[model samples]
Target: MRKRVLDVAEESFQARGYHASSLGDLMMAAGITGGALHHHFPTKKALAMAVIEERVAAAVEQTWIAPLLAAASAREGVRSVFEAVAAELERQGFVRGCPLNNLAHELALADPDFRIALSGIFSTWRQALADKIASDQQAGVEQGTDPQRFAALAVAAYSGAMSMAKTAQDASILRDCLAALKPV
Candidate 1:
């Protein structure tokens, strides 16, 4: 039941802004009656927070951390993550912005907790990438690629490119951005 609620909330949260979404809609989407929803989550806001927490961790691990850990070279691993993003943009037709970033922007003004949580998640991601870059630098001495700066720039570029691609409905733009990133 918890999984169902979270899954349904994720779908709604991804499809519509959190402010525009309601408990009734979430329950309906989950195929649960009113009581069933309350049994799992007393309030829609609480459920949203849970969804944010779970989604943030999952997104971070799958999109960035995993790739960074998997490659023989941390640098190549970081590169792979960006490449994966470009591939996803192409796969999705570039119509949807990242769910996490979208939710952050929407919930920032409405919910301070949500904003804080989202910022923390992003900070973790940035730190992970920066650490990986630093690791690569220590092993290979790749000068001109300041680990912290590279990590920050890469994420900013990725998010900005994704935003633009989503706005234009052109996934190719994401690929173009990835291609422009220095091969580190």
Candidate 2:
């Protein structure tokens, strides 16, 4: 029941934004009563925080961090990720942007806890990428670049590209941005 509620809330928040997804709607979607939801999450904010910390963070790990770490090279991994996501968005025929970015835009300024949680996730993501880059540099697969700076820039570029592609309703923007990021 707790997982059901969290799943419903995550989907709702992703589709409708935090402010717009009322508790009533979430309860209905999850097929749970107020008593059940409150038993697990005392407040809506608590539920949102759980969704961010668990669902959103896990999504980033599965989609970005794990894949990048598992690949033979950071450069190849990042590029492969870009291409895969572009193909996915193209197949879906719509862009929803990054889940983490969407939540950050909606809830970061609304509460300090939300900002802290989101920032922590972003920090973890950046650090993972930086680790991969540093490994590649040490292996002589890359050179003359600061891993931290490059990781930050790559994340920022992907976030901006996703936003633009979502707005333009075009996945090609992602591919074009991938071209610009060829050096890394």
Candidate 3:
């Protein structure tokens, strides 16, 4: 039941901003009563926190961090991730944008806790990419870039591209941005 609530809430918050997803609507979507919902999450904020900490963080880890870590080079990893996302978005025929970015845009300024949690995810993402880039540099697979700076730029570029893609409702913007970055 707790997992169900979190899953539903994560999807809901991603689809609709946290402020717009009322408790009643969430409850109905989750098919849980007030008592059951409150038993796992004392408040709507608590539920949102859980979704941020658990669902959102896990999504980032699986989608970005793990794949990058497993790739042969940071450049290849980032390019592959962007290509994969663009392909998936094209296949899905909808641009919902990056989940973490969506939440950050909506909630980062709304609450300190949300900001902290979202910042942590972004930091973790950047750190992972930086580490990969550093490793690649040592192996002579990459050169002429600071890992940390490149990682930050990559994150910012992806976030901005995703936002633009969402607004334009076109995944090609992502491929275009990736080409513009010429990421290394």
Top lDDT model = 3
lDDT of each: 0.77, 0.89, 0.90
Q: What tens-digit string does per-residue lDDT give for candidate 3 at 15-109?
A: 88799999999999899999999999999999999999998899889888888998888888888789889999999999988989999999999
Clashes in each model (backbone N, CA, C under 3 Å)? 0, 0, 0
Pairs that collide in candidate 3 are: none
Instruction: Judge candidate 3 against the unseen true structure and give its global Cα lDDT, from 0 to 1.
Output: 0.90
Model 2 global lDDT (CA atoms, 0 to 1): 0.89
Q: Which segments of candidate 1 are over 4 A away from where they belong?
A: none
Tens-digit lDDT track of model 1 for 1-184: 8899898888888778787788888888888898998887788888888888897568777888888877766567766777787777677664667777788778877879888888888788788888877777778756657777877886787778767877788777766775665554
| TM-score (C-alpha) between model 2 and the true structure | 0.96
User: Which of 1 and 3 is the better model by TM-score?
Assistant: 3
Model 3 misplaced regions, further than 4 Å: 181-184
